[model samples]
Target: MTAIRTLLVANRGEIARRVFRTASAMGIRTVAVHSDPDAHAPHVLDADRAVSLGGSTPAESYLDAAKILDAARRAGADAVHPGYGFLAENAGFAAACAAAGLVFVGPSPESIAAMGRKDRAKEIARKAGVPVLPDAPVTGDDPDGWAVAGADVGFPLLVKATAGGGGKGMRLVTGPDGLAEAITGARREAAGAFGDAAVFLERHLGFARHVEVQVFGDVHGGAVHLGERECSVQRRHQKVLEESPSPAVTPELRERMGATAVALVRELGYVGAGTVEFLLDEDGDFFFLEMNTRLQVEHPVTEEVYGLDLVRMQLRVAAGEPLGLDRAPEPRGHAIEVRLYAEDPANGYLPAPGPLHHYAHPTHPGVRFEDGVAAPGEVSPFYDPMLAKVVAHAPTRAEAAAMLAGALDATEVHGPVTNRAMLAALLRDPDFLAGETRTDFLDRHPVLLAPPPPTPEVVHLGAAVAVTAARRRAADPVTSLAPPGFRLLPGSAPATARWTPIGGEPADVGYRLGAAFGDTALTVTVGGTTTELGLRDLGPDGVRVVHDGVAVPCIVRVHPDGSVWVNDPAAQSGWRPEPRLPDPELSAAAAGPVAEVPGTVAAVLVAAGDQVTAGQKLVVLEAMKMEHPATAAADGVVAAVHVEPGQYVEAHTVLVTLTTGPTA
Candidate 1:
């Protein structure tokens, strides 16, 4: 048996950090490889040694197998862990590692090659007696032939890229007219993402549940399955929330699926961690989707449920350890995980990459947070925008969902509008609570997109908390004695500050020191309503506002940009105090449609001096491997196109100027 001494992680972000933690716990030295953009990333700092790939994009850095191999060699790493994405599923990379005499902390190269292509994997599964949906290989450039194949599979089918997963190269087609466009888009995306343009047609189950069984195999010809996880809650065909021990699967069905997954694992001689994905229809029938050849992003749910450390298991298996388990352990509790990304759910979940000013997670029991970066960090547009994965475990599913929802509600994630609010709302959603989730969960429920506005009480409490915090910071021996708002001259009015909640209108808060309680007590008035609250305790720990003989605890922080964050038990809100004077620089915002994120200009659909209607896509911006199109807000004529394809632009950079009367 080969014991791994120095290990290298050939990936970045949360997964890298996760593997590093496990390797370190096992007394193994860890090395991290990063691109130019991730030079100062948390994972780099977490490693004992880090190698610089010296490139800004994945193609020039992480995706380049040669650079990674060199990095491992220079770091003297005997084992390399390709933590999901990047080169994780590249069969050639696995073989190269083997040829270089380094243990790849994953499945064998043969297994990876066999399951790398969706089309080929389906064939293998069908031959192994596993249920699979019929598909047709999309070859050649004949549109008519493609149409006939798509029709043969029936309407409402999927045009999917056979190379990689993660919803990158998959499109749903409703009829014949959409098939060609879907194939073209899927091929382009697949090539850009995976370097493979091969695609195929598969029957689309619009209302199916995406479930996957977590199976582990060892070198001693032993294998076991760890039940299944449900990943049906999705947006843009990507999973948003996942839970283990799927509510839709019964004990009998789970036994059948687990057996099938283990059979396939044994059939392929697969080793280490892998997931066999399936699409379960409403009629209790399941069909094989594709198999992921590495550690899944949602493995935490399984670990939490089974009381096992999957990363540790992978490490042991890579070291040629035998499967110690005779059978899968009975899951103790239900676990739920939600992916927290740096995107805007309100804006169609657009990638909003920017500086993460304040990032924090709850430390409550039964709650676990796997994060990629800390506060005062930047969410680079060069990589995936996922910030962290929050998981919760409990005895019951409802309890687990509620626990997860409450934790998210208490989390303080500032900057870059996120889907935190939406995730929290979905966890508590009625249909979600009833376990009626399917692939079209988001489509069926649109109200979960936007967060509910803060209550009046919360707003009032926020104003009080903000004032109390400011006073505490400004307090001195002399100032403490002065009544609140007591100016040098008489007849002076109390100080009034205009503050706006994150999603609410601005309100003027009048604060004074003298209150019904004592000189230290405070009274705040907003919109002709007054509340008396005394500062019980105020310091770095937090502040307590006493109102009606009840003290409400709050965490108040002032951001570098002058925005005040107030997190209490009721809600978490940011209050931006209106500047006393408007700044000249901020007033120069362009009067045109601007890029909402930093990305390369994929295409410019319109030329200068062209007439256009409202909502016409004028420019397409590609960021984080997703395309975002800038559209016209009103009917106008294009005056000038500021950017061209292949040009990189920053957020708020004007793309195209549209004039109503004439072109400039």
Candidate 2:
């Protein structure tokens, strides 16, 4: 067996850190390569040695095989682990690593090439006696040709990019009216993400569940399945939640699916860690989807359930070791994993990349957090906006789901909008708890996208905290020495502060401290209701509020942008102190279509004189490997197009101005 001394991870973020953790545990030195923006990333700091690849975008950095190989060479790394994304599935890079005398900790390049393309992979699975969906490759750019091809596949079909996963370069078409645009959008997104515009048409199963089996192989022709993960809960075709031991799968079905996956693995002579994904229908019949040749994002659930470290297994297999087991291990307990992204679920899951003002992880039992960014760190717009992966393992599925929900609710993440609340809500959702989860879960339950409104008690607590903080800051060094409520004038007017919750109207909070020393009683008024609460343990960090004789602990954080976030057991709310006088520029900028996120303009569909209807696409912006279209809000003539293709723009930057009605 060839032993590896130093290993280099040709990727960034949590996966890199994960590899480093495993490699370090095995007494192997680790090397990290990063782009310019990721110079001080957590992954880089976790490595024993690091090399800067230079450039920010993936094309100029992570995707550059030459730079990665050079870095490995400079670092004297004997092995390379591509921790998903970037070039993990790149066959040429894997082949190059082998040619350069470096051990590639994955399947052979031939296997990658064979399974990388979804169309070819389906054919291989079909030939191996595995069930597969009917599909046809995209031929020409002609809309009519695409229409004919799509018709053959039937209505409610998916235009999927053959080269990549993660929902990129994928579009759903419900009817003939949307077939052309879906094909165009899918091809464009595919080319941008995968460097391949090749697409295929496949029938869309409305209620099909996405399930994948974790399969591993060794050089000695040994293969095994480590159970299955149900990743049916999705948004925009991307998985949001994953769990091991699907509630819908019976023991017999699991065996059949696992055996089927193992058969494919043996057929391909696959080695290392890989996942065989399938679409499970209501009738228990399953169809093979694309196989991910690299370690999956949701592998932690499988790892937790199986009590195995897949990364360590990968390292061992790369060393030319044989599988020690003849069959798959029986899973012990249930595990659930949720992907926390810096995105706005209410706003089409748009990537919300920015500085994390306040970030606190929950230290709850049975919870595991794999984070990529730290507090006060910036979520760069150049990469995926996934902030962390939170996994919970327990004796039962219900306990695991509840534990995960509580942990997520307790996690204090502020600043840019996130899907934390939505995730927590989904975990606690009744339907979800009952395991009614399907691929259309999110589309069917739109209310979950928007978090429940903060309770009245929580609102008052936030306002009270805001007022207390303001009072502390306003007091002079000498006046601060006085007792908590020692007012110079008897019966003085109560201090007042106005706070406006995000997307809510401004509410006035009037508060007055108690008259006696050590008296934590504080009278707070929110809207038309006034309540006397005990504000004990007041500090810069947090405060405890005793309302109705029940003590409720709260964590409050103030950002430099004049926004205050208060998180309590019930909920978390952020409020921006309403300006005394609104800026005049706000009204003037309301008549244009604005970019929802910071990104580069990919296309401009309208000219200054172009007339457009409501919902007509005016411009398309791409960021975090996803495209977002800026559309018109009303029928209007475009007065000006403010952006062009290839132009970088900031969030809320106006892309097009419109002149409606008489103004036209």
Candidate 3:
């Protein structure tokens, strides 16, 4: 162990900011490392000293062990803290830091190497008499041994990548027929993702809640376990919501699970922060999953409930200080965290990365937000989709639920579509509130209700407001110089404007600028209807005017290229057929030949002369972990094939051409 006074945070974004806050509290000087794009990031501004890692892509910056180590050395940082993701669990990075005489504020390289492999973790769990899923290893050089091992586990087994998490490179097999194929596919994916193809088998539990205990180990040979977190709500094996004092955990179960987790960490000499995950069955029977050898994404909830600064504890433990385990442990209250992601829940939750147009968080007590980026546009596709983690703590679970719901409702993130509403729904749903949920909660019940279609009246009101704002801009030059309108403007509109009139007749009407009546603030005039509007904001972006006490967002936009767009947000939408089919002349890129869309090539189906029809799946492109099929423009023979099965192509890179027309 080393006495580290200056720490180098070998990561970027919010996690880095989080680590620095704790390090700074300990009177430790911090060194921040950043990539080219993140040079001006908040984390950089928070550090005592800053260094650039060079390059924007993760591989060129964060994962480059040499660059990170050099940064630590140059910045005079005696220790490096690999915060959570990127290279946190990389045993190689840990060893290199140790070999360079720098303290790695995490577990030792040997411990990481042992538990980082999921198979080895299972073995450790089994030897410690921890309850593990009934399964057998299928790895062997002898064919007879392979058959015997396969028979022992039988069908409906899972092939899990030994070096993977996040459900990547894991396959579910329901029968022996698909066992080999599934394993092969799992291995390929695992190799591509973790750079290791080794996999093992396990029993696939159809229904279970994911609960994990946080445990800490000390050099003085003492280990203690914290309470468990209910992580039953997950999407694609990634935890979306987490809460402590799980409804499933009684006093007896909590004690039993906590003891088991502590025993494993002590027996394995696991140090620093780690999570021991277990699949809890309905009958209160729990089995060991695997240990995550680094900080977890959902650690904030635990911190809130335990009243502990986990990051600070990590630093103290790594510094060879006693963990202060002289006293007993206690966990009180309830805490919950919801991951705010830059994704569209309506569009199959596809990643929606772009510049944020506007953002504002709900301000209230008992609410904490750990964010990676802030307003003024900072969403990127090259990183994880999570934008922030909003956490709330309360004396009771009900209060916690209400707190989260109110916070999300008050949150204003107008830049992109998010799962805030969905997460809020989960917190308020009866099933979730009672803590009775499974991993398939979202899949079994899609809470995505298409908002009711925008009322034609609102559209008409929007048209009127657009016309008013446009005329206002032309009428007053001083107000035009102001921002769109005002920051979340508050007022009472003179009248509620309607786009098309009632009785199918168009009309125009306005109220006195300074007139008020009881039961209503501003007067509204329609062709045949008069109403008032509780104005929220009146800006260049249009008016967010509420009528009949209902809020309606009106988008008033004057395009830079001289186009006007005024519309209401659709509550829901169904897939509609395109009225205009793609034309050959309208192919993308237009550089002699159209190019392939941005994605990883799943397959190239056509050759130089194979005939194909329109809408045929010519090539499958996988982006953000979803398969998108690119089809042919029209019926034609493939003139030339350019892409391979595993080749990565960017947007507008020519893939194939049609023989029927000159490669337009």
Which candidate number has the best TM-score? 2
Candidate 2: stretches off by over 4 Å? 453-457, 460-475, 488-498, 502-534, 579-586, 662-664
Candidate 1 residue-wise lDDT, 1-664, digit = tens:
8999999999999999999999999999999999998989999999999999988877889999999999999999999999998889999999999999999999999999999899999999999999999789998999999999998898899999898788888999999998987897788778777888899999999889999999999999999999999999998888999999899999999999999999999999999999999999999999999999999999999999999999999999999998798778998889999999888787788887877789987799999999998889899998888999999999999999999999988888876667887899999999999999999999999989885743335444544454654565467665665454443344446568787765457888776654334424566788998876666555544567676767677777777777677777756666677745543432332435788789888778899878888777888787887778889877789888889998989877888887764333
Worst 10 residues of 2 by lDDT: 458-467
Number of the top lDDT candidate: 2
Task: Estimate every model's Cα lDDT from 0 to 1.
Answer: 0.85, 0.86, 0.72
| Segments in model 1 whose C-alpha atoms lie over 4 Å from true places | 140-145, 453-481, 488-551, 579-591, 661-664
Superposed by TM-score, candidate 2 places the C-alpha of residue 570 at a distance from the truth, in angstroms, of: 4.6
Candidate 3 on 124-168: residue-level lDDT in tens?
899999988867665754546644656687766788888858776
Clashing pairs in 1: 484-513
For candidate 3, the 10 contiguous residues with the lowest summed lDDT are: 570-579
TM-score computed on alpha carbons, candidate 2:
0.94
How many backbone clashes does every candidate have?
1, 0, 9
Q: TM-score order of candidates, best first?
A: 2, 1, 3
Give candidate 3's error at residue 591 in angstroms. 19
Q: In order, what is each prediction's RMSD in angstroms?
A: 3.5, 2.5, 7.5
Per-candidate TM vs. native? 0.89, 0.94, 0.79
lDDT of 2 by residue, 341-388 (tens): 998898888888887787887788889999998877889998999999
